[model samples]
Target: MPLLHKIAGVVVVCAVVLGLTLPAHRRGAEKESPAGRVGNSSSAAPAAKVSGSPAPSGSPTASATPLKPIPAAAPGAAAVKANELGQIPVLMYHRIVPKPEMSLDRSTKELYDELTRLAKGGYVPITAAEFVSGWINVPAGKHPVVLTFDDSTPGHFALDAAGRPKADTAVAIIQRVAAENPGFRPVATFYLNKELFGMADAQAAAGLRWLVQNGFELGNHTVTHPDLSGMSEDGVHKEIGGMEDRIVQLAGRHTTTFAYPFGAVPRKGKWARKDGSRYSFQGIFLAGWRPSVSPFADEFDRWNIDRVRSEGKIKENDCTKYCSTAWLEYLDKNPDERYTSDGDPNTVTFPKTAEDRLAKEYRRRARTY
Candidate 1:
């Protein structure tokens, strides 16, 4: 059997044992609630210690060095307050496809059922901004869920093998759920990269416009989706600025949020160029750089906000299987942990093994509790 299958089997066995051993009330608490309750204050301390490098304080032009003993706050508190009553989780998704071969991606039916389940569970969907701004404060007993789609693939908007928007089934389910329950208005964020527009057969350009018109927010995922750390100042500007330009032209809106491709900085610093170099020119123009590893400072970078990537199979019946409410709860209780990359921002290091990837996942999930 494959590693994921083995891991899945282990999870199943563990879940069964956990279910049987846990107290009845606790078991009920663990019974895959509609959504994990987000606490108003994060119990976990800041992940990284801000260095005392005497860097310019609070200036966009400050050096990009990690600070030590950084002021620790509740997890995600700087970006958005923890849901005091309980919060709606912002789930991240990359692609949705029908073919079984694309296990990494989800099918339309699966996506539809997932939304239907959220609706049935009384989970309200909110936008990423709403989650960050701490607005739309949901009271206790009210469940909220945020849906995000990354990579802006054409398959998301078009039919598969047939002639339909690939995400039509899922979108329909979301729209239906939203319409049926006024309080359950579901919102999704699309992190688009301009390069992906013409790669596929479908007219993705037009589809993006359609998504925005229909009430979805278009977010920036950088122009070419390259690691920004190693790139010179100029390179960063082009990567970010270029995409912002395209998003405005296509979606008729300027994007404030960005998703880091591969989710880490480079190590070798090949992408880094001198401040005056042509490549450096782009970086100089960019509003700022957001490093995912530095959750403390990164959250303050409104233009380059950090996000936790949701991985594994996302089924309507088992949305929490990969990232359960229990796990998120655990993260909420322990906030010092943050996601990190192989090297500094310029030169990046990719995960070398399944263990490495799992470790990364474990760390990312640790914050949600």
Candidate 2:
């Protein structure tokens, strides 16, 4: 193969291999439970608060629904008035490695400590559906945070020297924290590609089944975890729709949520694909991929919501920084502020001059994978 072809081939092979092995090795729950079923919404609009009004009494409810709207405060009142339009931050993670050598991963101990801090600090870790549904209403003082893990890496469930699934370590951490903190039952969503779930590994399959059986929800990241913005419509369907099918098969539930691989969204370019199969400008808009500084638009696709990446070793203090209470507070006050632009996922109106530079950086980083 030519040098370029060789590199492309390698990329394709790696993607296939990683896709196939990870899910097979770390399978969890597949059965649907009340927790998994309650908050699942195919549409994102249902998740937003409606003009500071309580949802109709018959509207679907979740176990941890957001608090009902209180009367608007008097002008200049002492209370810090809650912004009814606040955007919920969906925090993302790739790995939780134990050693500095594995910087992307957080150690077992570190993961536990971080969860503990979140609980004590009053951060409610909710599933994507819950966040989207505006489910699990908490008081204005209690902010909602969505915890997500991407890639479905082996380390997420790898065995220690003693030969036990490493996921147990993370689960144990959550269990302990939940035990001590009664009201801090944090739920997490795991986005996995079909290739990640091994058809041959019974143990891994069981692990995934267990995840769904428990309170955790499974989300579709993509069948191959590719950058959809650059692919053909068929490619996008294979990546998005294919993964959704696989997740439903493996997890025994239909998955409506999606997380973009490398978080890339389509730009305002012409679509070369045939009509009827072309990308929907409206669908893209509903996907919530826009410049961060635009006025907040409530329309969104629960499947392709935005996320904030969490990195480095997971420490309790790091959680404070990663979760950024200040940032959450800012969003709380300025609910109308957008996080990404409709024209391009990478563009942001703030610090306006750097948009091109930032977009270039994003593209370069994405090309590596």
Candidate 3:
């Protein structure tokens, strides 16, 4: 070979060797949006996927994997007759007291018994955030239920001497029931007020952090639990935004969901969903009598989600038909009407007959068997 050709060949070989041996350049991290600040929409809307790790103080920390179409065999859908478009019971509780003193109060034993029944019936607990995000990741043949506690009462959460959950509290009872029943998730969403579970500032902070660390979600229930329907837009914003700031200060996690104080949306309904970006609730719940439609259902409204009261079949309390007891029994009798998981989070599976009931946006994730 000529000297020039030999030099060219050696240069080519050196370039190839360098390309093979050099380490790949690291890609810069993508800038993420502030967590839990999903768009405010009346209808069910697509929320940005949140990062899993906790953000800094006064910021939000949550995670949700956006669903995508995966055209795979859904064996569990047909065998379980899974109905992704069916009703989901987002049961609401106010006070888990030692004794039932009022219509809204549930005794400790009653709460435990109800949870036990839910566990036995193959119901898995998911947070309000997950429900509103349409992230129902339950196992096959399991039903997703949202166990939400409002008011952040002392009975809702507290710590014992050794930092364990105190006995007779809702947290302790839920943990106990979950331990007894295999696969029963102890997770729940506690909508907090300014009171912070009636604990001192330090204790409250510890309790709030513990709940979040242990898979529980903290939500906004306004600074003062007021009848929002009668409040002005400014008043509503103050209450909601004030609560959001307080939650971030105390829990260090932004709230992803909100529950109306008295199930009352403002005269202008949009105020319930947002307040100038101080807080943006992906899901806003009402104190409802019946179970709500699936998040992916055509009629589902993220801003006006329904939540059933925690009561038995008592005519005096006017819960004979629509309360949790009657509703749970009704679902048991009519299993096909309840939301059953297809065991795949990425795909939303339902019967062919219910195909039309699904939201059009979710068609990509829809799997009809």
Candidate 4:
């Protein structure tokens, strides 16, 4: 009787082990993991030596997907309103260079420090897509930031010899910062003009794919980087629509944001328009001298969104006119007006005195502390 019981137990155990192991192996084969596909993104793009990079390429895939909207608990609460209300600063940068002759041109070290400062200050980088869709749902007490690079310079992106992104570019710095900081995310928006990464066609295409696959974002800065104030209606359409087409061709997705060139748009409502030929963008970013209001603020408008230029006071130049320093200083002077996270992302919290000024959408889920 004992021998028969032992034999039956062994057979049962063997069947259980096979059931557990076979499904895991099958699951592994079902989908292409991020680790395997990310490495080969630069293989199609030939290496080019550029001043900005080892330096240049092209956009969004990452393991930690962006916070999608939660279903609304109240009637009339749109999905976007499900996002907690908080202040978000979208920083605009250009030329992540090794050496900086101009104040606008930031060195890699400076970029690293800025990212570090944000991470240490309880800030998380959100993509431009997240900003536009109003899906920013970062953990409680963490502020959302958007690091946007205009001009698609070589220093913004570059690939190493082994078909991997170089670690010193802005993209690499963002990713590296996220790796070191537990809750920080590596994401930024790159606004493209021609010759992104100094690669013409094929390499540029590859670079764009890499950016998209790695969870970074791409936006339209126009094909020729023209000032829209001087252009006619048809010209404005061409400047934006054309770039959108090329970016889609490379990334296999629609680019939903547009940044104005030289901080200028042709008309008030004219910043965003789609002819029969193209997809209309949801966000239009302005060149800002200050941080923007909350995406859900009563004053906030998607088409006329603002982005603070990334520049600290370098040498003798005061960059506050076009940089974010001005707004930071203002907040320092009047801290009460500044939006601060109260460490609970599930429910929106702000000052009781500030309640009357909040957007209608925010008031629903809001709790004033």
Clashes of each: 45, 44, 0, 17
- Give the clash total for candidate 4: 17
Using lDDT as the yardstick, the better of models 1 and 4 is 4
TM-score, per-candidate, Cα-based: 0.49, 0.54, 0.81, 0.71
| lDDT of every predicted structure (CA atoms) | 0.47, 0.48, 0.86, 0.69
Question: Which ranges of candidate 1 are over 4 A from the true structure?
Answer: 1-88, 137-140, 158-170, 179-182, 195-206, 265-369
Ranking by TM-score, best first?
A: 3, 4, 2, 1
Off by over 4 Å in 3: 1-73
| Per-residue accuracy of model 1 over 242-270 as CA lDDT, tens digit each | 77777666656666445556654434232
Candidate 2 residue 67 C-alpha distance from true site, Å = 23
TM-score of 1: 0.49
- Segments in model 2 whose C-alpha atoms lie over 4 Å from true places: 1-84, 100-103, 157-168, 195-201, 267-304, 312-369
**TM-score of model 3 (CA atoms):** 0.81
Per-residue lDDT tens digits for candidate 2, residues 1-369, read 689999999999998887777743244423332221222222322333333344565667521245332332333221323232235566666665565355445666766766776677556666765554434445334445667777776545444456434554454456567878887764687777654533344554666777767677676677677776787766676566666555555666765355667767544222311124222112111222111221122233333455554443246435434543444545545544413112112211222222222221122211100
Model 2: number of backbone collisions: 44
Candidate 4 residues 190-290, lDDT tens each? 99987676877888888899888888888888899988887878888888888888888877887878888888878634535465558587778888666
Best by TM-score: 3
